[model samples]
Target chain A: MASYKELPKTAQIRLVSSHEEVYEPCDDSFALVDALLADRTKLLEHRPMLCMEIGCGSGYVITSLALILGQEGSGVNYIATDINPHAVRVTHETLEAHGVSAELIVTDIASGLEKRLAGLVDVMIVNPPYVPTPEDEVGAEGITASWAGGENGRSVIDRILPIADRLLSEKGWLYMVTLTANNPSEICLEMKKKGYASKIVVQRSTEEENLHIIKFWRDFDNEVDEINNQSTFMGSLLSQIPPFSFWRGNNGNDSDKNKC
Target chain B: MRLLTHNMLSSNIRGVVNGFPLRIEAGKVVEKNVEINGDFLKNMFVKIDWKAFVEASQSMGYTELPEEADSSMLDSDEFLNRFHHALLELHLEEGALVCPETGRRFPVSKGIPNMLLHEDEV
Candidate 1:
């Protein structure tokens, strides 16, 4: 007998429509979906009223999100935006195939709707253009927009962070995919400055690259870390610097400080 | 295009600000019956733009929806079914969405409205 209580699954490929110019669901996309699944319990409890996706590609991530949060959260509204018009059409067919739906827009990330949707999104997701390329290639036409990230793959990612911050509600949650080459820790540090707490929800190493799905949310207590950092910066550096063997022999509390 | 999709669409052409509620000139409208799910309809009510919805419905010859969404009608199964029929079942098969500011016509064919702007217009 089938289990009466089964976990929701991502949208099947049969339901995912495609086009030549659109980016299909790949390792990065699946990793993003996995991050969402890992956080599903918190998500359902969050009861997000509005969910938005930037750079939707073939609609895989948004569709997976909607399906994973199915009936219990039918009230959730989904809107997906892509710079590629072809992606918008493919997403339409994909959503229709699964008997689910979202408002599809073709434009730069949430361009026209920025004013209307400002600070209204409860959940936002992105598997951005993170492949290193020339700055000119970052937002190029058609398929190039799918994976062309210029100079450390931060061009598109940098533009998206501010927009995500502007669109996210006070309690909003954001999940984004980043490559190891993109410098994940520095990205986290940058978000820390913006008062967002982040963690690597999913990390996968494939032949091509190391992918990290980072989840960030508003941290009201972020200032606490800042205060602690100010007081402990020198102490932390002493623990990290050379002469560790001598310092350890001299200080009995070396292990205690190193624990951090 | 379903009214649900229509509600969120706005013209993004350069220099044309406030492209919402694009004027819909319906050439053809198709209505097909779909399963009635009360919960979905109830949830969609709050997210929907009542004024744009009412205007678009009236344009497609759907006069069942009231000028304003009534909270009292949510619990009624009959009203839920009606709302579902108007929103999910009705499709704008062929039409032209005229940009409010720029007066550009975006053609809707086979129930898909092309909102793609030209290179310079983007």
Candidate 2:
């Protein structure tokens, strides 16, 4: 049997703080962190200078990323933004509880930071509001802003794609969570036009939902004209992947730093 | 927020040009120790705007940073220490980041800046 020492370091569920108005960490959050964990080796080698999270909903994902990266001597910087003020505060407490820190801002996805962060971010992670809902429901207030994606769950995702493109450096990488309703394939083709090649890092399906964590990076080889011809093929290729992996509830137990 | 954040932030309000450095209104400043990494500091030096960074540190009541700096100065241990302190250690616990062009104030409460714009601003 694998001992506790073999377990990977991530944000402990007990250490993660929460607020009624803030979106609590759920399955989607777990999937995103698991993807990061699976890619931990590449991330360490990536040596990203600045890592950011667009919607740091309970701070679970960002905190997990920091722990996975082992921030002490790595000299990596973290920044997170959320539209809801309560989420930011809750995230702060979560980070504090874990002895990790990040610059948290209450903003509408990267607003007021575009010029300053443009082409500077090396790694950006997002668990966006990909849940489909009424258009008016999008950005309503509080927790609603956390999951209300208008019109086929593309409203917020659409807006963030352009901003992600602008802020990402030439070597930047983006990992985002998407629901099946959000049309992950079309999203990949859209990003392809902007010279980003994407691969699904994690795919999970449960009784009620299908989730995919997609990672995108600048691919100079994918020219604009070439993307037009490949769009249909790319769409089919992405859509055909079977959701074979079921996310195991690995975060069920509360484990502290000294457990090992 | 730290000066490194300040160095990267600008007044992104609509129709505002030349908002490279949002003027700092330091209300309450705090310093926390951060482990110094010379390689990180040296790499960041090329990307940082020295003039704006110096001005930011001065507003935070840290005047040790020189008015002008060059890459060669990064070799000095003293300069690196000051640079590290100014860049990462100092935090604006309670303050406001004023937009240079419109004089719009974005309040920084509990070290978290409220950068969300009103509907009109959007």
Candidate 3:
């Protein structure tokens, strides 16, 4: 296992700018590189793994993952993406400097994923924008999209959840990191509804805050339940038409009042 | 420069109004040598602001970029090579990104830019 203390200077930190500039530690990145490295032995056992790091700022974690994975001779392919071109440039530079190989894309998570990555990812990692305040815009550099999660700080995550549900493979795992301000229970519940089971893998308490890394796995058992429950009377009746067919084109449907 | 930081940046901090795009008044911009992973670049192409990228590159004296970029460009060695050099290789060691809106200057020294806002601006 690669020790965190032994990580190279580049892996330890990076200069990040979205609109403002700041020094970001590799550990401060949404996905922890050291943790990912430590998990490699177990990860490679499942060989030819495909990994993705979303919102990769300055290419810290993704480049680090590429370097480690490349050296291990494990067929680990990575896709690191961000919305800012500058970030893409920085990530590319980092990967080049480290001699690590991975695909880098510049795209927003809200616009759905690249078609090439569809249904092919084995592991997905995200360090989404979770800042809860609108006025808390300090240090929001070139990539405001990387930190702004909307009014409730859930807009970005909520938009990505549906896309994630479709992109992740049946046996794939998703690792996400966010601050305590977000409602963990609600996020897990949403994941559950999308046919995945989640667990908190890492939790840390700093001087004034708590941080969490949650891991989500596809629920195969739920697939069987869905299949078994498909033939029930209610299910059969619901299958023939759209769930909100009565409200099609505003047919005076007051059904929304009863939804909750 | 980070796009999020770029989005909030303006040159008119002194009293001007149209500081949408901050100009990079770099004295010395260096490009760190880094590798290029085509697959990752392809996926990321959709999210980048192409115009901003071109502008930044042009300001840095890279004038050979195509008028427009397409996904196919990711596979072009020439394009990738140039892009790699422009985006990843260039470093602004001594410069300032002047806000067009307020004319407030954010200085870049020793490869780092000070972006701390004033108490009143916050």
Candidate 4:
């Protein structure tokens, strides 16, 4: 069974849709929640925080975070928005059910952001469309807005970047998730061009996909030891494989092969 | 709406060549409790683009999905419950669906879609 956690006082409230139909929260949100909870010391120091969740569908992250924060004695104000009105309504219902309060809006991030929310965001979290291939487009209504990352899976992110820059506080943080398909390195480089330094804070690989969560911070240690260790181990293992084995001309040593 | 629907939607009502990526302008999004149909969901799993599904559902504020979903997990009650929630429950209420191409907006109210275009647009 899935368990719920309370968001800390210094933490920003999460906004997610509880309506299971139109919007279902992804696992990354849980991972993020867990990470934040694990690092409560750091998060709590940033008191009176405000967060904006772009493309908040059913209110999974926002609601969960709000409940968690309320329990943790932190007062968090969250603004969750989506282009779909239904998404916004569903999110509102979810928050109400949990006795958490959040401001929900239905608007296109590509067009612009709500004025009232301007320059008040301490953190901006986004999980934009990042599918890479044309063949990746599947379901109709869901896929249209969900995937279809324009030409290079950067369409939506590109549009959101400017808004994030504008909405974020001078020392605010941007937490976003993107796929390997989006070429995270390139995206991070682009963000640097916008005067922000970005780094991959977390990454996990599955059989079919590579998931990455990037954080753009004003000053953060980019040295990720765990990721580096994992990469090195994987590299060494691959090098030992038959395909990567050093090939010295088949020494006429048939007996040497059998001895091993 | 399914990702497939979004892919095929275009603003080509008449001369609008930018007919791709039809947005969901939901008005009355609802969650209904439906019987779990694992077989159907499992079969359709392959057809689904998991990333798109995750992103779409997450955008609506849901993030309870598994990182890597496999059809084999469909037999488990835990997996089925999540699948059922994601596949059958969410509904769009009222809003305008936009076309990524021509910047066309389709009005949606009371869970119904209004894809009609202007006479000249057609």
Model 4, clash count? 60
Rank ordering of all candidates by TM-score, starting from the highest: 2, 1, 3, 4
Every candidate's DockQ is: 0.26, 0.74, 0.03, 0.02
Which model scores highest in TM-score? 2
True contacts kept of each: 0.18, 0.77, 0.00, 0.00
Top candidate by DockQ: 2
| Interface RMSD of each candidate, angstroms, one decimal | 4.1, 1.3, 11.9, 15.8
> Which segments of candidate 1 are over 4 A away from where they belong?
A1-8, A71-73, A193-195, A221-260, B28-48, B69-89, B109-113
Q: Local error of candidate 3 at A106, Å?
A: 1.6
Model 2 chain B lDDT-worst window of ten: B11-20
Query: Which residue pairs of candidate 2 clash?
Result: none
lDDT, candidate 3, A129-159, per-residue tens: 6645453541255655566554445667776
How displaced is residue B112 in candidate 1, in Å? Answer: 4.5
- In order, the first chain's TM-score in every candidate is 0.85, 0.88, 0.71, 0.68
> Would you give the TM-score of chain B in model 4?
0.68
Query: On TM-score, who's better, 1 or 3?
Result: 1
> How does model 2 fare in lDDT?
0.86
User: Native-vs-model 4 lDDT?
Assistant: 0.55
Query: Model 3 off-target regions past 4 Å?
Result: A1-10, A14-23, A71-73, A110-114, A135-141, A223-260, B1-122
